[model samples]
Target: MLTQTLPTWLPRLSFAPVNTAPRGDTLVVVFLRGAADVLNMVVPHGEDAYYQLRPSLGIARPDDSKTKKEERTVDLDGFFGLHPNMSPLLEAWQSEQLAIIHACGAPDESRSHFKAMELMERGVDDERGPASGWIGRHLATLNTGNSSPLRAVGMGTRPQRSLSGSVPVSALRSITDFHLGGDLRALQQMRAALETVYAGDILGQETLSIMDTLQKLDVQNYQSPITNYPDTEFGLALKQTAMLIKAEVGLEVSAIDLGGWDTHFAQGSSAGIMPNLMKDLAEGLAAFHADMADHQNQLTTVTMSEFGRRASENGSLGTDHGHGSMMMVSAAMWTAAKSTGSGLGWRKVNSLGQVIWRSQQIIVMCFPRF
Candidate 1:
């Protein structure tokens, strides 16, 4: 029998209405911090202008005999394709669970990373005024009548700005630390003292909710077969995320950010820094996909950066900050596309949803080369 233990707040602790429960669907946001070149990451090989513009940095189309198969984009409906580094996710896209939203942005023109990220996270279209994050709003909308302590969790030391709101969210370094063990009487006493401290103020309410959620995370049982994660900070972070998802604690949202993509220097498209970074990201995400294969239907992962780099490479073999980025939605959303199993080129439709270009539109063709 399945038992759901709803948390009860002590009289001293304050509380707010719990957000709506998940419909069993999960939204994972992969924030690719640092400006990543959307054009290079999502190669527009079929576009002549792409090749013509970045003679040194441009990736070749699928049929380009000079390009190695492993380095080429996996075809997707003959238009936009996945980078060779992202071959792991290709299967997901082929499974029709993945969809790509190109030329879409935060609706803010600010080039500053801080400002752009703020606008995107806050979900404000006009780029003005204080507003909650989209996920926070989504959580608010999802909040059901009764409070479920285990409804939302962010897998880290502190909750991302996107997860902050009136609702209480759990921030965990690991599942092991979320619960208390030992004597029941001692546990109750400790909780009582904590509750006494929390009851009198705004923090009291959040403390109650957070403690309840942690307790829930503590008891959840989960196991995964032997797996290896890279030693990098981002790599470890992703591995932890996989563990939480596998735990099946009713997680509805997970936020992750991977940085060092700001390739203003030595941004090699084919080899060196950029390629290595892409490789790490690809491997991390691939491992995550593999770990959650069984739960694909209930999960959708999305990756995004603030903006793209310049269309051309600089003297230092890197690219500068530019505009118009790309987003990789789970292939699960477009099950039909993944079924076909082919690479694709660029197709340009402006941010406003107008078809500005028909055949493989890369950077120069997609944007005005500003």
Candidate 2:
């Protein structure tokens, strides 16, 4: 259950958000905090160079007879394969609900975790750019009639920099914390007082409305009837986000974090530390996909990392920070090229830094229903 207690007086800075129909699907951005190894995550098994460089760390080919099932890659397109632990997503892959964008990343070329993440989150080429995030700008500009105070949410302690624009975003931890002392009379009295104090302000009204919205939800006790979600922090976050969406609380975008991808030490190839991380990720995602089965076409979940680790495994058995990154979109409405699997055109490149990281359309391109 959600445990953190946040003040209901979270800040917001915005003018009137034009009330209109939804512009698109609810977008959930899952940020893998530490630089993730996209090469390993989305294994390029057909590329011999991948195995040549990191023989010890590369996942075994799908057809490798001697490799354990847990160590072998789950064939996607013969060329690209998902790490074995991520096999749970095969449902989405085969169902054509998952689109993998390879080698997409910030062109800043900074390997420092903090700098790279800042640049990526801000959607800037370098440090001398706008402080607000791309998503922030999107929400600010789009006159989608989503007026729910919980419209844009940062799922943890602080809002992600990408959600740092002018349109008000709520930095929240738990919906349960807003239960208002668990005393109905006190809650009514407090609500009356707050309504009286914030009577004429738009932001205040929105804030009060958000409280009212959350008050009706039972998020902390939510349990998906169809999916047995993993009991991890990431899983719980996704679970609660699903609850908010189902409650129709006007949650447009949510930024959830799953850190510790900086596998500089003991970055397991198929069965160790890295695979464990992938298991947690895959299980949570699969469960979310199942739990939200009813709202398939209305939601889009995307995964990203600050940057990708080096292609070749280092002497320390882990990869170094590099520019190779990939993005994944799991949506029932994937409208991009019917990618049968090839790493070019709609691709993003190897962390080896040899291939040019050319850009291409991903989000809106695939968001046709939106």
lDDT, residue 133, candidate 2: 89
lDDT measured at residue 8 in model 2 versus the true structure, 0 to 100 = 28
TM-scores, all candidates, are 0.73, 0.84
Q: Each candidate's lDDT (Cα)?
A: 0.62, 0.75
The per-residue C-alpha lDDT of model 2 at residue 138 equals 72
Best by TM-score: 2
lDDT of 2 by residue, 44-91 (tens): 888876787787898899999998876798888878988888889888
The alpha-carbon deviation from the true structure for residue 319 of candidate 2, after best TM-score superposition, in angstroms, is 1.0
CA RMSD, predictions in order: 8.4, 6.6
Question: Candidate 1, 229: how far from true, in Å?
Answer: 4.7
Tell me the tens digit of each residue's lDDT in model 1 across 1-85.
Answer: 1234322211122224334334436677778888777777767665666666677777767777888977777766665666677
